[model samples]
Target: MRSWLLKSLYVLAALRYPRIRPDLRYFVRDNYFARLNQLRFWRADFLTKTPYKVVEFYGEFDQEIRYAMPFAYWHFLNGTLKQTVASKNTRPFYFFSPDHVEKYEKRVWEAGYGNYSIPNMTHAPTYDFSKWARVPFKSHYQNDVFVYDKPLLVIANKYNIEWDKPPINFLDIPALDRLISGLKSRYQIVYNRPLGGQIVHDNSEIMDLGEHAWLRTTHPEVLLMNDLFDQHAATVQNFNHLQLLVYANCNHFISMHGGTAALASCFGGTNILLSHPGGGFEHEFNEYNNLFPNLSGATILHAKSREEVFTLVEGRF
Candidate 1:
């Protein structure tokens, strides 16, 4: 967008949503322009001129789930999605009916709205899903082999580089200990921190938290995702598929920020996300209360601090 036009849009956004922070107001501007841009395709979609509309994206996993995936799902529901494209290991995510996702690209997601071409996709996910259909991940992936004695609680943690810096919005050993110690008896706890190369890398470098050995020694009862992967290696297609199976059966999750939380929120449950670095847009736009829930009616509780994680775990979880 031109600088002057961008300024004018920002002004319009501020006038529209005067109470929100400046960041979100600009997001509103971006979304409005993005919607305007989508008008170009109306003729094709309305006329059914194309046999199918192919939507392709290889962006950051978080943004993909937050914006792109849902946008594509809307097209699929409306009988227009012919094929979807993304980076490797995302077949499980797009495994809705007539699932056709070709994962052959490598594109690091920019912080900017690089996926504006996706119909209904914006920097911040919209609250309404009237045009969206929740992907039935649980129905497709749920299995009796993954059943547990008690209700499942998936603890999806990640220690990855954030914003060219060291790990942020991750659960350290102490926080893990507290979560396990507190919720051990009530639910079947599953600990997950996908090692480097296990999934697609999107600019963020996966750093070792060195908590796996500690979890084994300190809390042997908790099921480690790595261990589960090995145990069910013969049965599951890949790590992402394993997650879909396990998380499909789970109703409670304690996930770190970004993609980890995004995946967990796909299932209808309560996900307590640990985002220590100010909660980002998830807080700024109240996505936790609105957009996140739109995924599968999951209650996304954003904990801006580790202390608040415990508080939310005790009270909400």
Candidate 2:
């Protein structure tokens, strides 16, 4: 009955935001519903704060970065966060908190990736992290280990499965060539495209772009993330750790959409996110504009096409 009522009310909200797909109407409404639950616990936060105030997530990396991390960090700031639970190799992200429990849920990854993990994070009005505490990943990881003589520029690329289609919003080799040729002289480029096993697997499969060898041969000056992970095998925990450390130093990024762009935004820089799809949750709620930037007050330039990418690169980067 409650689901039926929200579904009926969602029709009105959908008309106002018609870009959202029909199937996601309830998901968005449920987020707003869960958000309303916050008021019921507002008074409890100060007096009832306890070690039980934990946040667990095994969702899409993008949503995890946008919603789950900040939600947990907010609990940390409020002194209520006790133990964070998530998949493996994520301690680096939650190191600032009191405790983190790494428990990989490969089976549940299929259903994860929304504001459903915790109730407070269900708010629909905002994704702003300004009032919230920003996880000090950059300050904690930024060190002299990965310093470069030139200003570092990270091009975090992704070539994999996406709901929108093959050209879901990743840069092909030719476009990469254009960016590298244009920016390599001014910046020390670190090209990142994590292999499948390196990052926790999800529904999305990592399709081979076959660009690793091309980057080494075509632009030997450019750094590859896989090689860096190999070179600093003992120094960091995993590929995610290396990315945080390296990305912490740079202030400019050209990345594919989804988690790649979200991670880049967390470190505070100008992130050119290639997002062309029209009907994903990103477009549905239209919240990423605020959510991504507030992650660290980063400047985000959304380029809907490959041509616009270079245009923003020329003007912003």
Candidate 3:
């Protein structure tokens, strides 16, 4: 009868539309709530150093101060948009205070490079000087501030962040061993991690990764990577800043910037780009609109993917 028909429809609907899983619901809710905690922690950290209302309108202070270009660039430029764009492998031009610019140029000479490249494209912040200028170490020259002494090199283990891929720890002993084996020169490298706290001492100086103790190697001292996320659990928002800080402290930084040659320019340090032929830079996430200076003195030769990383070092040294 009518009741039976209604029941049949109801059963069919129930069968077709299953209830959301409790675990998934919890995961979503947990992340939502966790984000709030994360925001509170980030705000507290900034407030401790700066005024409370500095980031009041942004809700989360960290996100407002540290931005991802394209979407955030407008906000960063205070709603001013620039028309500059990269055309088929052009280098980016950047301007610092005259004093900082002199120091910046000198570092480039010491690093023995002209232009640095980082991956980039349409949506990225068209300019990210603020993000580039702030070094984690107290010593980095900001704007007009300049430090010319021998600096420490800070490297972030961002290579393992491929979406849908496994999270590989650079501090993992076996992996470091393999990575070291591929290297010829002894470049001092400190691997930075996200610990969700203030970055303290370098972890590579202490961690005992047997056989992977490439740190023992005098020339290329390899440091262990620490999880900055775990340490700063509330404040550190992204790993890119960690890399920027490292670059600020170190004599020079070598990175693929997730394979974006354009990001290297805005980052304000020496960079080596790994170019992939015919890949058309298609895989790169260029939302940051990082400007690449087209000047020859500003850029180095691009390395095709066919070239091994070790080989590049051999020639550089």
Candidate 4:
């Protein structure tokens, strides 16, 4: 329903802003600063021979639109600003923030980009993080409220079996059971909310959503992005980036659909899906690879045996 409403809003926006109507994905939800980032990355001439001022405004926002930054700094910052007499040959970057935007704001500013605050982030209008925000930061709003004393066993969510197609497996009971059986001895378990583009209906008669089924049946405690869990305060407090950082730093594990493989690959952690048979979907067939070079790594292993799955994670810990 929320997604539908957002889509409707976009349709309405098309009528209101004809220029953005066709490229709503690049415009609509973006704030002025984020919009600028997209412009800069796409146009290189935006910068002069001088160094560019690249202000990075980061916070515990709900989501981070990392891809848009490259272009924004180039075109908007360097192009327009650099053309000005006072601003010529140098770049200035501004980041509006509510939380940790300061850290990023400072880093980017000190490194050459200028930082400026717009309005107080706490007062920013609340909306869905996926559609517009550069990075989701709801969890960052209440950082002190949640704490993790012991090592966390982070289990990210996978919306479905096949993102491009309907799900073939309705219940990944074996995967869940084996995960529990395999790691029960080594770690105190807690399932984390799954992020990334994988979308699954909580109740899908079609595609029989296997990932949702596993969460509903076995690890009823598993966190759903849509639903807040007991650790909702904590999870929200930590935001999703902290989870990634934790996984990157601590003794964490990954058992996800192939969508998460790139992060797992970069972090050097145990990604359970890597052991799947035939390495999941081969990306050579994926059409979007040209626009999104990252999708080329969509291939993952579909587990052939429970033992193979168990062995994959067992060695990682």
Candidate 5:
């Protein structure tokens, strides 16, 4: 009944606000139905028979890292009761699509929750991280097994929707070059470009979804970083596991404000998060600072100027 009402509201919104019709449609199709399914599951007591409590996290990339992963971690630390998480990326949610479920399922398995995880549930779980906002996240997972021999520095550059916004967290080619040049000598720099032009829902046509052709034209240095550093570059396609492994093992991480950075916070390494001042630094800073807490080596900084970013990166090294 509520779902039907929300669906009606979505139709009304589409009719009333044609300019944002696509965005509204997405909310109705993905967000609403996913939550409705979750409500139905809870009311039906579907997981009552299971030994471990199940948390169905059906959100996009940012939500998974920022909310879902932490929500699960908090529960793991606070209680002895075993718990599993169903981290779905199916329709209505665009971050982790069905095509990429295998990698995420492998991630869940590698994290020692193989028995507990249901990474690809078709019905999908609802997004309900607000309940765990006040709850603290501790670094209970260790990366000793995954650490590299040399000091590792991980960099995650985002050039997607942020490109349209004011230059806050987005780093241009020259800036990236300077940073990479300075750090390459001391630490093994691993670059991660997790998203690409392909849309998660449909893999056929290339869209201006992520770091489109702009990165190649403007920031060729990002592509050249691997050759310069004698290391293989990591992207969404082949390096999901290695990306997480490097994050877990890295000594320091430099990342743009997004899902990738949020995931890095889970590893409890020194993280320098660059945020755009005009892009809501105060909100991002407060949310991350609170979510990860003091113990977590996560620092959110305003990237108003390139000099500040350079200084922060240099200081970390």
Candidate 6:
């Protein structure tokens, strides 16, 4: 019935916006079908019974890096604990979408959960457990780390888009160049780009930001310094796991305020979050504190300007 209703809404939207029907179709698929699958699995947890504890994560499939990785890992830690404390005969079973199941199967299994699965309408109920879980930061699954040989500094920047209000939480090309130049002598710097199409706005018009926008739309020369500096377009090349691995091993991380920053937080290193005070999202810092309250060898700083960022990075290194 719900699927029928959503399909009806999609049809209505298609008829109403005939000119951009293709975009509307994608919008419906992402917003409706994806979210509906999450809801179905979440609801199934309540009706099913298992010998072991069950934890359900349902929502926000679109931003896998920001929402899925950190949130799912948190639950995976909790599910492992619940199973261990309950009984050796029973083990926790985690339910996630098949896409996630395929991508993160090894990591989920290593976190100590008994089983992870994709659910359907007829699936039995599993326990609905709630309570945020925290675990030590370590490279649990992928043991092979990318050794930079030299001191490594990972930089994540946002361009051609505005994610925050007022001052805007982005570094201009010149500012970024200065930051990179200042550290080039001391560390090997690598730029990490977000994995997905960015939004480009021209006056009142908006459209998808092309994949090569970073290389073509911007001054490519600014990024292509010498062998000392490198750029990794993770999203354009679909290098999600590789990006995570690099973040896991980097000596330091500097990122704009966004999902990538959140994922970096999980790695537990010297992290500097460049944020705009006008954005009014200061609570994110406190939330991260709670999530990673016991992280050792980790220092997190919030910087708003080039000088502050440089100073923070210098102080850390």
Q: Pick the candidate with the highest lDDT.
A: 1
Candidate 5 ranges beyond 4 A from true positions? 1-52, 74-149, 163-168, 197-238, 281-285, 294-302
Model 4 compared with the native: what TM-score?
0.40
Return the lDDT, model 5, position 89: 29
lDDT-wise, the better of 3 and 6 is 6
Tell me the deviation in Å of residue 296 in model 3. 14
lDDT of each: 0.78, 0.77, 0.32, 0.35, 0.47, 0.44
lDDT of 2 at 266: 87
- Candidate no. 2 TM-score: 0.90
Candidate 2 structure quality by residue, lDDT tens digits, 1-317: 75675776587558765776677665656665555546565765767876557788887787677677887888888877788888888888988768888897552444443444455243243343432566777777889988998999999988887873564778889999999999999999999999977878677777989999998999999999999999999989988889999999999999887888889998887898888857355654565575677788888898878999999999987
Q: Which residue pairs show collisions in model 2? A: none
Residue range 94-211, candidate 5, lDDT tens digits: 2222222322331221232111132211111123342233222222223464445468777776555543443346666677768877876677666665443222211112123233
Which model is ahead, 3 or 5, in terms of lDDT? 5
Error of 2 at 138 (Å): 1.8
Candidate 6 Cα deviation (angstroms), residue 163 = 5.1
lDDT per residue (tens digit) for residues 1-317 in model 4:
63564566556545655643264322342333332334434343334434433333332121112222222323243333222111110111112211112232111112111221111111112222221222212222224433355444555534444434554322255667667656645565555444332221222222333455566676664434334333354633323334433444433545443434333332332344433333332222221222122212222233344566566567655
Q: Compute the lDDT for candidate 3.
A: 0.32
Model 6 ranges off by over 4 Å? 1-71, 74-130, 135-137, 141-145, 163-167, 195-237, 283-297
Superposed by TM-score, candidate 5 places the C-alpha of residue 31 at a distance from the truth, in angstroms, of 17
Which segments of candidate 4 are over 4 A away from where they belong?
1-150, 159-164, 168-171, 193-250, 263-269, 275-307
